[model samples]
Structures are given as C-alpha cells and as structure tokens.
Target: MNRLKPFYEITVKLAELLDQDINAKNRETIISQVNLLIEKRGDLLPEVPPPFTEDEKRVGSDIVLLNNKIQQKMNALFIDLKREMKQFKKQKKSNKTYTNPYEKIQTMDGMFLDNKK
Candidate 1:
C-alpha cells in the first residue's frame, strides 16, 4: 500500500547503512535513525495492514540478509576485540613481572626462637 512506502524506503536505507564500513559515530547515528523509523512504523501498525506485495517481500528478504551479515560482522569484531584484550592483559602482566620480578618470592633464613619458662 502507499502507506508502506516510507517504511520500505527506511528499511532499504537501514540495510544500506549496515553494508557500509561505519565508525562508532556513524553507527550511533544509524541506530538513532533506525529507532526513529521503528517508532514511526509502530505508530502505523494499529490497523491490520494488507499482506506485503512481491516487491515488499523481496525488500524484506534483503533486510533479513543484511541483518544476518551485520550480525556476523559484529561477532567477528567481538572475537577480535576479545583477542586483543587478552593480548593486552598478557602484556601488562609481563610488564609488571619485568618491573618487579621478586615481589612474590619469600626468603627466610633458618632461625629459631625459644621461650624460657
């Protein structure tokens, strides 16, 4: 229906944004845009709309595929971030050891104290 055109267009734009190599600032912008569109779409959904046309279905499918790709990229990015964090922790620990290698060692010469009654 004509009413759904704006929703479709926004969905397509969201999918295109997901395809971009967006930085954090741009990502936040995209998130806000998507949130606004969701709110608008929700407002329009009070009435039961007709079934999607073929083109709309295709666009919906494209959105699904794009979402999946975005999820995959997020997973990969998380993995890389975790790996880097682990490496950074190891480096920090090694630096600490290098700076103070004997901090944890305990050395006590043999000595005995006897109490007299």
Candidate 2:
C-alpha cells in the first residue's frame, strides 16, 4: 500500500487538474507536474498504482454515465431546435400567403362582367 500512496495522490491531483477547466498556462503546469512525478517515480511506475478492490471494479467509473447524460442533452437540444424551426417555417408560410378565390369573370361585349352576379 505504501507504494500505491504516490499514485493515489497523483490520481487525485490529475482528477483535480482535469475537473477545473483551464487555459494554456494552467494546462501546461499540470502536465509538467505529471511529467515530473513520472520522472521521480522512474521504473517503479507500474508498481505505484495498485489495482482497485472488487467493489471499485464492480462499480466502475461514472464517466460513461456522465457522457451519456451529455449526449442526451445534446440530442434533446437538437430535437427542440428542429421543432422550433419547423414551427417558424409554418408560421412564415401562414403569415404571408394569398388566398385568391376568383369566382368568375366574363369578357362579353368588349367589357368585363362579373358572372357571379
């Protein structure tokens, strides 16, 4: 377990680094820190991080669930946008339209006459 301590702490730090959105400067800092840790650990890298227990193995990371949630949100947003566009198009068509019902027109005696009359 002593050997695993360094990796555990490193994993925690990595998680922290990834959790907060950072700009280039902060990203470079975290990456450099990781590289330094790796150099310090040297050949002991594989031994440093022990495998998770059975429980952890069973539960697994929540990353997949989080990813699915994000995907669902994106899909819903796309569907809503498409629905809105469809409604907007329908409104546009309804708003500007010609409902012309030319009942009848007769050209008789060189004059136009309304046949409906």
Candidate 3:
C-alpha cells in the first residue's frame, strides 16, 4: 500500500469540499469540515517518510496538484468572505442611519448668531 494514499485522498476530498457552493445554511458545517481536514492533513504529513517508489511519486505529484487547486479555492473563498463582510458593514450602517437619521448630525457647533436690535 502507498503511504501517500491517505494524504492524496484527503487532499482530493478537501478540493471537492472547497469546490462546493457555500450559502448561509451549510456554511458553518462546511467550514468546520474544511478545518478538520486541514488539521488531519497536517497530522498525516510527518508520518510519510522518504525513499519514494514510482507509484508513490506519482501520488505525491497528484497531491501537489490538488494542493494548488485547494490553495486557489481557499483564496477565492477569502476574497468572497471579505466582500460579504464589507457589504454587511455597509448594510448595518445604512440600517442605523435609517433608524435614526439625526444620529450623525452635528448641531450648534460653537457658532453664535448676532442680531441687531
């Protein structure tokens, strides 16, 4: 049995999970699973030793490709998360302003008006 087999399978599974469309409902579960897979991947890394066979080398190369795909997916997800956060902040500010339009207004800023009698 190839030592890298488990690692390769994990990477492939990670890639698949990252490829799924994330919405509000399953977002938390998917993220948790992704984190678990990442930890597992880390734990499995040190177990595999050197002196690679041809099949093992092939699996190793496949794992590299999968890693690249996974990195790209993660980057895309990060960008999307940033965009959503910005939108949420904007929405919150808008809601606040809608609720109290005078909240941000400055009144009587140390200016006095004089009138001639």
* TM, every model: 0.54, 0.35, 0.86
Q: Taking the tens digit of each residue's C-alpha lDDT, what string does model 2 give over 10-102?
A: 544444544554444565675576566546545546663447665443333443344355355445545755787799999876665534333
Give the C-alpha miss distance for residue 26 in model 1, angstroms. Answer: 12
| Residue range with the least summed lDDT across 10 consecutive positions in model 1 | 41-50
Give the Cα error of residue 84 in candidate 3, in Å. Answer: 0.9
Shift of residue 65 alpha carbon in model 1, Å: 0.5
Query: What C-alpha RMSD separates each model from the true structure?
Result: 7.2, 14.0, 3.8
At residue 80, candidate 3 shows an lDDT of 77
Q: Can you write out model 3's per-residue Cα lDDT over 1-117, one digit (the tens) per residue? A: 368888988999999999999876787798899999999999999999888888898888888998999999888877877898999999999999999999987768888766677
Cα-lDDT of candidate 2: 0.52
Weakest ten-residue segment in model 3 by summed lDDT: 106-115
- Which residue pairs in model 1 clash with each other? none
Task: In angstroms, give how far residue 78 of model 1 lies from its true place.
Answer: 0.6
lDDT of 1 by residue, 1-117 (tens): 464566656555655655677564576676676567667656755542658788767766766776676567556656755787799999999999999999887656666555687
